[model samples]
Target chain A: MRGDTPFIAGDWGTSNLRLWLCGADGTVLDRADGPGVAAVPGRAEAAFLDATAAWRAADGPLPALFCGMVGSTIGWVEAAYHPCPANVGSLASGLTRFTALGATMAIIPGLSTRNPQGAPDVMRGEETQILGALASHPDLGIGRRLLCLPGTHAKWVLLRDGTVVMFQTGFSGELFALLRGHSVLGRGTDGLLPQIGPAFIQGVQRSLTSAPLPHLLFEARSRQLLEGMSAQDALSFLSGLVIGADVVGGIAMAADGLDGPVTLVASPILTDAYAAALAATGRDTVALDGGELALAGLLSVRAAILS
Target chain B: MRGDTPFIAGDWGTSNLRLWLCGADGTVLDRADGPGVAAVPGRAEAAFLDATAAWRAADGPLPALFCGMVGSTIGWVEAAYHPCPANVGSLASGLTRFTALGATMAIIPGLSTRNPQGAPDVMRGEETQILGALASHPDLGIGRRLLCLPGTHAKWVLLRDGTVVMFQTGFSGELFALLRGHSVLGRGTDGLLPQIGPAFIQGVQRSLTSAPLPHLLFEARSRQLLEGMSAQDALSFLSGLVIGADVVGGIAMAADGLDGPVTLVASPILTDAYAAALAATGRDTVALDGGELALAGLLSVRAAILS
Candidate 1:
């Protein structure tokens, strides 16, 4: 039963590379990883080959489906962005295919749309994750939906009739990291939020009241000095403030244009923060595990290619 | 006049220390500078001694007056903060006096006030700058006034009847530096805005329309990639967005409570940016040189101490 060679599913981005060897039944049979597109030097052909050598030796030359920053202009092979509104079928059709080292290969294209200000916004791997979410829950495709993928660059997406119509990018997560590590206001914070605490809720309340975030961020430090806030509490407060601002700003940008139950496709860590922020603003979220969606997306693309 | 060295006026901060030898007529005779408190490894006494050695050789034992981070907890000697509403008289009375290196020395205390959110807000050297502004232009002491000093830590101060009632700090400048150097949004930006251009105005307009700043900042990169914005334009655009956010947010925080023309006390470089941003928001500003105010503030404090 295990004699048959399988396909490879790769998620490569700026920071790290994650891979899975999937059987014909769509179950993961083996795993592999390597440096991300940013960390790999030269052509990246060697690194890819090296990362998968053992699996290749066991399974023979197998076809691979890759997503994320590997398709970016700065990545291995630049697969140009496909304009939305696009669905799973359209995304698969746009995949840039190539062959090297006796293996079939395909790289998923990123998505681009005009933001609220009518400027271009983009996302790479998350598009596949969205596709995977659609695959897992057909009911999610029935109506208009708002989807959020929270991470270093949080993406707030609008899906109309199963196709991603538009999206916006917020630098909230990146900002939190930068400020916590390198800023005076974030000096005392340790960059961890174990549980949603009082400080976090207070931060959400403050963000709702405070306009223009830069003016209020310093309170992270000031509160510690004046009110004896702990480092962990300060981090939580900062997180809530950023998330609250994102939610408020995202809604304002949406401006009643999109409607549906909000589907949050993120890791548990991010989901907790976003869920709390959304709840504070009187909105509820349906959580979707990002890893499951990612795998499902890879399988859908693989099936499309084989067909 | 050249024969007499009346006293040493120093603006010592976390990063840099500037000193001036002043004559009895309040004219600067000579100047020197050195690394600030943070740059000095162990004790700051040595750096202070070295910086003023030339002045000491000429003047014997001149009294010194310092204002800035030199009075902070991490500075030369911990000069405790004076609570507002405080004017020059109250500020002078809070001075921490000491005798070292056969020189009579005193450091002006920083000012602290609760912001609109009831969080602690503080400023050190800028307090002396405010005092200097009052000394140079007596008219500034009248009515309720707002003062903005834009820098690494931009300060927005409210003065009522010649006393500083309250203030807020925005880390706009530092954020700009960090983003430009460290964050992805600031990539390719040279961090120089030779003059405000169309790109800059566009940034201000975008910021005004886009409420939550963290969401909108990504436009700096999106515009460049989508519309082919040049690095110089991108940098200018980023600067405008930051200034705009600070101005808009600061006004909202003020909440129609503090009423007066904003006294922008800064160097020519910062004044240009803040002035343009304020003008864009339909607010006029009265400009004052930061150096002039720092000297005036020191002289005022010295006079207070002597009297």
Candidate 2:
């Protein structure tokens, strides 16, 4: 495969899908989105074809590379998880290859590792993001680095010389969603948006204490009843508490004595929250766009496969 | 107000209402139930009147005493929170009295106190349960005691000479329910009942570490995916993690340096789970029936009012 040959790349997850049509030099010529693996279930191939129908008709038989839950049991094809201490080359080699719609398609294997607690931890899409981060920043490939990818199931990865040594998964994002959408504390917060204001800072600082999360979370409601904290502030405060707990836990599990600015691979919104949280704990952070990193990661794997 | 004077007592919470028709001596004459305060909203008085219609017809103008969310803002009347360091006498004096359907009615004011973290904590029905526990066991009233009332918002209460001096609330039960009912970890667990088996013990033990909660919780999903853990065990494990975190946090907040077995004021199922979690940490537990305690507490309040 030539570097200039057009290709298709995607980062398909549980809830959404993003696909890019790239030129030989990895410039995104076009992009499309379709149902996530969860939505398509047994029909991932059909969904993928539908999402890229225009691109396929225009370009004719462009190879496709995918990462994330699209490789899981529920995905188009079950790609076996590449055991950690994995880098771009390992992931590329472990990719699950198949022929779909008369074109070569491969799903990048997710990474699996044992967390600090010796419990099994796994990452699907975030593995590609971390790899992309490493590819974009050569400096990050040196020595040791800690990367925090905030999402529905946030991943805290410890990288040694650009290889993912270990990682831990935090249920913060999903927990926050469930709480805000369903819990009692979220009762009157239907139209409210969480702000990075005093309430959030207070929640972050409160989460830093020895008080357990369950106890602290109730403050979202108690404060409203007792101190006149508005429902909007309450939502932000709840967000802070959840994210702060994740940061605290992630640092404990992955950072430890390792010294460096925690690399945050996420969108602007998540970066703002995570950066603020890390800053509160007196840790520095360097931000990277997760979307771009996913593309770069796919390119790196493509380079590896071609080589 | 003699001990054998027939009266109506009820515990009305967010989801359901439980009412008892008791003899003057506090013996149960009959029992009935109705929608909780949350269901009827501004029509709590009507709901109460409807639930107790049969009891009222059988026994005319029986004085009624209620506790729990019935006193909350959403309940029948907005009973003000009685500030703690409070005992049965203080609570009796703090009762929010009213007349509904031409009968003398009272709603026990919930207790309000600042948790160790200096955050506001409040409880409605649990206060009555605590008072009932004290009345049923005089030994509990003489010393500093720690009581764990497990429910939607589990309460950890510290008692000094029968007065609720301080307390903390853990959102463990609600979190567990939310995760089981809504989160990804709960998928495929529709009909499976959580058992206190190896997975639960493992979860409890896992939560005892300093790894923080969000990280520990994800193990339920990861273990299932990678280690072949069943949905049943995963639900139990998830339950253990949430409950264990609460127990750990509760002890740190309310039971610090306090001696004697932790008194668990809850129903049998909750008792089983809480006891298992506490026992894993070498903490001794004494279980008491929550329903019985509610009745006993109501009787104590009636006695105090008469005195």
Predicted structure with the largest TM-score when compared to the true one: 2
Per-residue lDDT for B18-101 in model 1, tens only? Answer: 998888766889989999888985677889888888878877888788998888767888898898889888987888988877
Best by lDDT: 2
Those runs of model 2 whose alpha carbons end farther than 4 Å from true positions after fitting are A1-4, A253-259, B1-5, B23-27, B253-256
Q: Model 1, residue A130: displacement in angstroms?
A: 0.8
CAPRI band of model 2?
high
Candidates 1 onward: DockQ, in order: 0.70, 0.85
lDDT of 1 at B194: 35
lDDT of 2 by residue, B89-205 (tens): 999888888888777789999988998779998888999989899999988897778899999999999988888999999999899999999998999999887788788988888
Residue B140 alpha-carbon offset, candidate 1, angstroms: 1.9
lDDT of each: 0.81, 0.88
lDDT of 2 at B41: 85
lDDT of 1 by residue, A224-300 (tens): 76677888888888878787888877666455655556788888888887888888877778888797677788787
